[model samples]
Each structure stands twice: as structure tokens, then as C-alpha cells.
Target: MTVALPSILLVLLFALNLPVAFAIAISALSFFFLADGLPLDIFFQKMVAATESYPLLAVPFFVLAGSLMNAAGITRRLLHLADALVGHLTGALAQACTVLATLLGGLTASSSADAAMLSKLFGPEMLRRGYSAAFAAAITSSAAIITALIPPGIGLIIYGYLADVSVGRLFLAGVVPGLLLAGSLFLTTWWIARRRGYRPTRPHFAGWGEVGRAAKEAVWALLIPVFIILGLRYGIFTTTEAGAITVLITLLIGALVYRELSWAKLPGVLRETVLDTSSVMLLICAASAFGFYLAWERLPPAMASWMVGLTRDPQMLLLLINVLLIVLGTAVEGTAALIILTPIFVPVILQFGIDPVQFGIVLVTNLTIAGITPPVGQMMFISCAVLRVPMEVYTVEILPFLAAMTAVLLLITFLPGLSLWLPDLVMGP
Candidate 1:
């Protein structure tokens, strides 16, 4: 009952509406206190140790980079590029929002940040142009999940750190799956646009010349991902170094190249990054203590053994785990779910000889989707509040996009090649 009691209490704390970091911290303390011989001091040690990680440094810097990039007008350039590529299609604005989300995958590496930005940027415009609030919110929020699947995804970095897997491999592995998600959404948007009689923004496609010009203007924005992947693969920088370097580059671009991010804005950006980084670091510290508890109890190995006993079939086991992740993700925030569960699941999957890189894609994708699930999905709340769409209405509207995303998720699940191919090619497996 020692371990089980704390696990139960953690759920109860969550149900009581406590903050996630507090919930995890309280539960770990309870375990340490009630255990027969475990000292309370080690809990504090684990908490501090989690923060000492070099890789964890990537979190704060990436948050700062994303915020400054947005302020620098990088997002605006990419949005224009998104428009050039798809603005002539049926449901043109909706299609462009999905495309922008893909581009944002590199820039923000954050689903919540992307969701909030997309909602504020496109929510009003889509509504003003005759799109239903439900449709606007659904499309924008669903597309935001794609951002977390792409390279430089903050979630992937966290997963890689927690699981002891290579972050660079995870980053490269995400490219194909992220694009596949965009393609699925594009098809879904086309069907919805045609059915609703939503018209295009432009009468005809932007010619190659227009697309070329848009790409030219957005070239600086586009190079960020290429730089990150190449730097990591080539051993030019560690993940932490890559994040710091990117932040410096983005600040210079914002201040000098675009001249959009003014000197007066530096303090505000730092303040925002501190707030974002604090929440993430706090969660990491708390979750790490609880993680120590799991290790002490040997829970992950026991769980892995139990599953392996149930079905030696790797495919069946993965399907079951994905369902659990979806259900768990609906309650916990994506990063929290990832931090708490990665230690448990990674060991389980590795038993089947599964590549952690492929599973990382599936795991992060499921959790991001949960970020959009009702009735308390973080992204869903961000989008609905901004667009003024009710949860019940959004629950209905997001169904089709959710299905499309699930299809893409399953493809990544069953076809390991989809996730592994790029990483193996680029990084030599």
C-alpha cells in the first residue's frame, strides 16, 4: 500500500483541483513520509537533481525564443508564406491556419503557445469572414497539436531527457509525422470547406513566383529548424546549446533584421519567458521526486512485466498503451503527462525491442491530442475562450479533425518506418 497510497492520493489531489506541481509534490512527500525506511531528505535531493539537468536548460531558452520570434514578426512572415501556399483552396483561411501550425511547429515547439497565438490571430478573422465560431475554434486548436509533433518540439525534448533517449533522433523522427498530420488536416479542411460553401481568399492559386517570393521573405524563419537538426546531428551543439544559440539568433533577427521587436520590449519578453519557464521547471522538479518513488518501488518494471505477460504481441501492447495515454492525457497537461509517464512507458516499450524514437512520436502525439480533448483540454480552453465557442459546441466541431489526427496517429503507431525513416537516414539510426 506504500506506493499505491501515494498514487491514489495524487489522483485525489488532481480531482480536488490542486495545481499539478503541488499535486505531484504532495503525493511524493506523502510517500516518503509513510514509507518504512526511506528518508524525507532524498525527496528534496531528487527535486534539486531534476533541475540540475543540462537538457532541461533547453526548456526555458526555447520558450524565450518562441516568444521573441512571435514578437519579431517571424510568425507573420510564415503566415504570409502559409497563405501563398494554400489561400486559394476551399476553406482557404482554415487551410492556411493548418499550414501555419505546421510552420509554427519549428518556431514555437509549443502547442499551447501556438494555440493561443493562432486563436488570437485567426479566430476573429475567420469569424469576420463568415466562418462559424465552432469551426474557427476547432480548426485552429486542432492544428496547434501539429506544432508539438514537429522538430524542436518542447515535449520531445522533455521526453528525450526523461527517457534517456537521444533528443536529436526524436527531433528528426518527428518531421515526417508532423507533415503527415498537416496533410490529413488539409484533406479534412477541404471536405469541410466544400460542404459549408466556404470560399477561397483568392480566385486562383498563387503562382510559383508568388510562392517563391513568400519563401524568400520567410527564409530566415524557415532556417531555424534546419539549423537545429543539423547542429544536433553534426555534434556542433548539445540540445541545450542549440536552444541558447537559437535564442540569440532570434533576438538578433527580431531587433536588427526585422526591426519589429524594439529594445523597450526586452524586459517584457524576459518576464514572460521567466513565467513560462518557472511553471515547467516547477513541474519537472515535482515530477522528478515522484519519479524517484516509482524507481524505488520498481513499478515500471513490474508494469512492463505484467503487460508483456498479457500479450507478447508488441502491436497489441502498443495499442493498449496508446489508449491509456489518451485517457491519462485528458486530465493531465501534456508536459506533465509526459514527465510523469515517460519513465513508466519507455521501459515497457523497450522490452519489445521498440525504438524509443518511434514511440516518442506516438507518445507525444497522443498527449498533444489530449491537449485538445474536452472538457478541460488546455488548448481547447484557450481556443474556445478566445473564439467564445462553448465546450459542448467545440466537442462536436472538433470530432472530424480529431478523427483525422487519430488516423495519422495510428499510422505512425503501426508503421514504425514512418517515424524511423527520417531519423535513421539523417542521423544514421
Candidate 2:
């Protein structure tokens, strides 16, 4: 009952509209305050101690790196690359949005950031192309989920940090799953375009000259993942050091090569980075205290046993967990839920002999889809607000894309090799 107190308080606090970090902090501190043997100071200590992790430094560096790259006009170059690659396809502008999200995934690794940027960039263009406001909003928002699966994604970093998995391996493992998502969305868009009689943005495919020109301009942004992965695989840098290096690389490209990000832009980027980093750091700290309470109650292994008892089949267990996460996602924000759930579920998966690396991909991808889902999806609201689309219309238009997303989700869930092969091959098992 005492252990359950925090869980109950957590749900109640969320229901009462408390902010996520504070809710978690209060719930966790209450457990320490109420329990006879537990020291209340330990709760405070855990919050401070969580920030001391060496791996956690990746969060801010990557955040700053992403901000600097954006200010440097990488998004425009990526948009051009997307256009050259897919602008001849049916529903080409919409298709470019999908491809751009994939390319931006490599650059930003942020679903929300991509969704907002794409919506503003493509929303007006799609409107001019005679596309429905809702369809435009749906594609932009749903495609952004791919960012969470790509290397250097903030979600991947947090999951890897909390799950005690290699961020490097996680980075490699994510590629195939991310591609699966992009391919599925591509096929789904093509099918929908054919039915709607939508035409490609470009009348014909880009010639080699056009392709080469665009890729050349965007080569620096494209090299980011390659640099990070190779650096990690060859022992060139630790994950934290990789982030620091990434910041340096982007700074040079932004300031010197692109010449888009200027000195005056530095303060704005720093401010945004500080705000973004603070929110993620605060969540991690609060989750640390709450996590300590869970450990004291011995909940993870207990829940792991209970869940395994419900079914010994690992595949079936994954399906069940996927359902639970999807339902939970509509209510809580993905990042907060991810922090809260990773500790509880990591033990459960290990008991089934499932790879933590694979689970990290699944967990982050699943929660990322939440940001596009209804009832409380942040991306949904952002896209809708920017495009001025109605929620009801956006909800309906998002279904087909959601189906495509779910298809890829199930594929990666069942096919461990899909998520595991690259990491195992490149970084070794």
C-alpha cells in the first residue's frame, strides 16, 4: 500500500492538471516522507545525483547542436534535397514533406520541431496545390515521428541513458526501423495520391545534375549521423564527446560554410537550448526520485513477474505492452511517460530475454507516435494551429497515416533482426 501511494498520487496529480516534473517530484517525495524507514533526504539526493551522469551531457550538447544547425539554414537545404529526390512522385510536395522529415530526422532528431517546421513550410504550399488543409496537416505531423527513430534523436538518447543501453548501438539499431517508417509512409502517400488524383510537384524526375547539385549543398548535414556513428564505432569519442564534437562541427558549418547562422543569432539559439535542456533535465531529475521509490518497493521485478505470468510468449507480451503504451500515450506526454515507464519495463523485457537495444527502439518509436495521436498529441495541436485546420478534420485525415505507422510499428516489434541487425553488425553484439 505504501509503495502504491506514489503511483496513485502520480495519476491523481496528472489528473488534477499538475505539471509533469512537479507531479513526479511531489509523488516521489511523499513516499519518502511517509515511509518510516526511508530517509526524506534521499529523495532530494536522487534528484541531484541524477544530473551527475556523464552520459546525460549528450542531451544539452545535441540540443544546442540542433538549434545551431536550424539557424544555419540546413532545413532549406534539406528541403531542396527532398524535392530533388521525390518531387516527381504523385502528390510530390506532400511526398517531399515525408522525405524532408526523414532527412531532418538525421539533422534535428526531434519530432515536434520537425512537425512545426514542416507544417509552416509546406502548409502554404499545399494550400496552393489544392490539397485539403487536414491532409496537409496530417502528413506533416505523422511523418515527424520518424525523427524520433533516427540517430542522435533526443528521445533515443534519453531512452539509452535510462535503459543502460549503448547510445551508439541504439543509434545504429534505429536506422532500419526509421526507414521502415519512411517507406511505409511513402507507399501510403502514393496510394492516397493516386486515389485523390493528386499530381507531383515536379512534372518529371530530377536529372543527375539537379540531384548532384542538391546533395552537394546538403552533404554537411547528411554527414552528421555518419560522423557520430563512425566515431562511436571506432572508439574515436564517447557518446558525450560525440555530442560535443557534433556541436563543434555544426558551429563551423553554420558560421563559416553556410554563413547563414550569424553572431546575432547566437543568443536566440542559446536561449532556446537552455529552455529545451532545462525541461528535459528537470524531467530526468524528478523521474530519478520517483524511480528510487519504485526500487524501494521492488515494483519493477514484481511487475515483470506478474506480466510474464500473464503470458510466457514474448511476442504476445510485446503486443500487450504496445497496446498499453498506445493507450497511455493519449493521456500523458511522450517524454514524461517515457521517463516514468523505462525503469519499470526494462526489467520486464530482460526477463523475457529480449534485447534492451531493440526495446529502446520500440519504446521510443511507440511514444513518438503518441505525439501525433489524438486526445492530447502535441504535434497534432502544433500542426493544426499552424495550418489552421480543425481538430475533427485533422483526426479523420490522420487515420490512414496512423495505419501506415502501426504497420511499421508491428513489423519492428516482431522482427528483432530489423532493429538489431545493423547495431550487431556495425558495433558487434
Candidate 3:
């Protein structure tokens, strides 16, 4: 009976078009009552436990920080700086969209938010520049996914909490793979631009004077992620406190430094932050109870034992896990997948001597790619809406980018050092 809960609950909730959070909670409650012999009160208890953590506070603060940065004009400035740097490249504006998305993602950590923002800011520019609407939508959506792997990423936060890994380390672990994905996507854009005769964004490179000016304007925007990582590394703050500090820093930049984030705009930012944070936290709380059901059934151990019987080799195990995540990602939200699946897989991977940090990067990277895949891809839908591109057109245009991202994912998976070396070098054993 316990063994049937994960699948049965999934089908039931999915059939009803329930929100993912409620689906998780209802399924978990069903299991608690039917098979686990647990009290109904455990559901509320787990909710309290899920919300009680200090680190969990980061969710709202970071969500708010991302909002504040947008309000403060940081996002606009970052776009200017990115355009100045890459705007001379072939397909320059498209590439700038990617770069700017990556930069703002560092602050926002939510791919959906990043994609929505880019759609508004860069979506029109791409259309004006003669890039096909479909291509622009595809690139914007795909580019925003780079944020999901960067430090302060909400996906990493969920993975950290569910798997009991250090949120800070997971944050650090994401840096290289995130940048690699960005570079690979850029190259793909260049190739497509050259083949399609996309015009260069600028006739001549901006001078040092312009570059310096853009960078100066964007400085405050750039330091938020760096401050979070350093604070966590030095024990100046936990991930939770760092989030509060992120809000403080963003307010200062928006209110004091930029002066663009006016008092009148405060309510809108707060409203959006609450909506986003509530959606995410509700999922976490629900996932916690669902996770408890899995534990109660002893599913992880059973699955781990079965997997070991199939293959004791670490690489084979990783390949299987990656394949599973890709399929799961198409149907499930990335955070939901990470919370539900990481526990089941991570222990199995560790048993085969795989580095948890390396696996974490590979895991998140695969899910990042999933965000752009079809049939319920949240980012894909967001991009299509923003650029007003038809699904079939954008899907075809996005293939090359997907292939490039896949290559990077495989590289990180096999070359464990790429993901782990920096973390080890900077953070030590």
C-alpha cells in the first residue's frame, strides 16, 4: 500500500488539474491515512516543520530581492552593460538577451521571472532587430534557464533542503556549469545568426568609455550574488540571513543609489514577491509532507537496493538518473522533481562513489534544460506569450540551443572536476 502512494497520488492529483502544491499535499495525506498509519495531524506538523527552518526564509527574501532589483533599475542597467559588451557580435541583440538574462537570474533565481522580464525588455528589441519572433522567444526562454543553475537559485535551494545538503555549497557548485551553459548557448546563437543572415546589433564596438560607463552603472547589480556566497563561506550569515541581507542591499540600491525604485512602486513589488514566494513556499511545505510519506514507506532503500542490483557502476547510475530527470522535468516542475527525486537518487549515487556535488550540478542542469521542453514547459509558455510566437516555430528554433545545452550537461556529468573543482579550490574539503 505504501509502495503505491507516489504513483497513485500523482495520477489522481494530475487528473484533477490541481496545483502542484495541493497535489503533493493531498497525495501525502492520503498515504499517511491509508498506508503509513500516521495521524492526520502529522500533515500540519510537517507544514510547521517545513516553514520553521531558518534557511527557508531565504526563499521570500531572495524573491523580494529579485523584485527590488528590477524596481531599482538594476535589470535595465545590466541589459545596457550586456548590450555594450555583446551588442557587436553577430546576432548581438539575441546574445545580449541571453547575457542579460543570465545576469539578472543571479539576482532573481527564478527562470520564469527572468524569462518574463526578458520578454518585456528584450522581446521587443529582438523583434525590432529582424530576428524572427519564434527565434527570439526561444532564445529568451532558453537563456533565462541559465539563472536556475546559478548561485541563489531557487532550484538549488529546494535541492539543498530536501537532500540535506548545504545550500551555500550547492550555490557555489552551480557557478561553472551555469557559465558553461551560457557560453554554449551564445555559440549556438552565433551559428544560427550566421546561417540565417541575422544582422549585427552594432556596426562598431563600443569604446572603453562607453563600456566603463555601462559597467559602472551596473556595479551594484552585479555584487548581490557575490555577497551571498562570501557571506555564507565566511560564516558571516547563513543562507537565510543572506536572503534578508539581499533584500536590504536591493532596497539600498533601488532607493538610495538608483533612486528609480520609488515609494509608489513598493506595493507592486511586494505584491509580486508575495505571490511568487507563496507559490514556492507552498510547494516546499507540500513536498516536505510528501517526502515524509516516501520515507515512511522505506522507498529510498528499496529503490537503492534494486538499482544497485542493476548496476554498481557510478557512471551508469548517473546516466539512468539523468534520463529519469529529463522525463520527469517535461511533466513536473523542476523544484518539485528535485524535492521528490533527489532523495531517492542521491543516496544511490553516493553508494556508487559519485560525488554528491557533481551529481547535484548534473541533476539541476538537466532540469534546467527541461524548462524549455514542450507540453507544460513553464518557461516555454512564458516565452511564447511574450514574443507572441507560435509553438511549432519556436520549438524548431530552440533545437540547436537544446543540443548545445545537452552537450554541456554531458560534459559536466562525465567531467566531475568541472563542477567540483572550483568549490573545492575555494571552499576546501
Best by lDDT: 1
Enumerate clash totals for all models, in the order shown.
0, 0, 0
Q: Best TM-score goes to which candidate?
A: 1
- Give the TM-score comparing model 1 with the true structure, all chains together: 0.98
- lDDT of candidates 1 onward, in order: 0.91, 0.90, 0.85
Task: Give, for candidate 2, the lowest lDDT window spanning 10 residues.
Answer: 104-113
248-310 per-residue lDDT for model 2 (tens digits): 999999889999989999999999889879988999999999999888889998989899889
- Model 1, residue 208: C-alpha shift (Å): 2.0
lDDT value, residue 320 of candidate 2? 93
- After the best TM-score superposition of candidate 1, give how far the Cα of residue 69 lies from its true spot, in angstroms: 0.8
Ranking by lDDT: 1, 2, 3
Tens digits of lDDT, candidate 1, 1-429: 666999999989888878889999999999998988888899999999998999989999899999998889899999999999999999999999999999889878778889999999998989888999999999889999988878789999999998899999999889999999999999999999899998999999999999999999889989999999999989999999999999999988898898999988888888988988898899999999999889989999999999999998889988999999888877777777888899999989999988898999999999989889986588999999999999999999999999999999999999999999998998896
C-alpha lDDT of residue 284 in model 3: 83
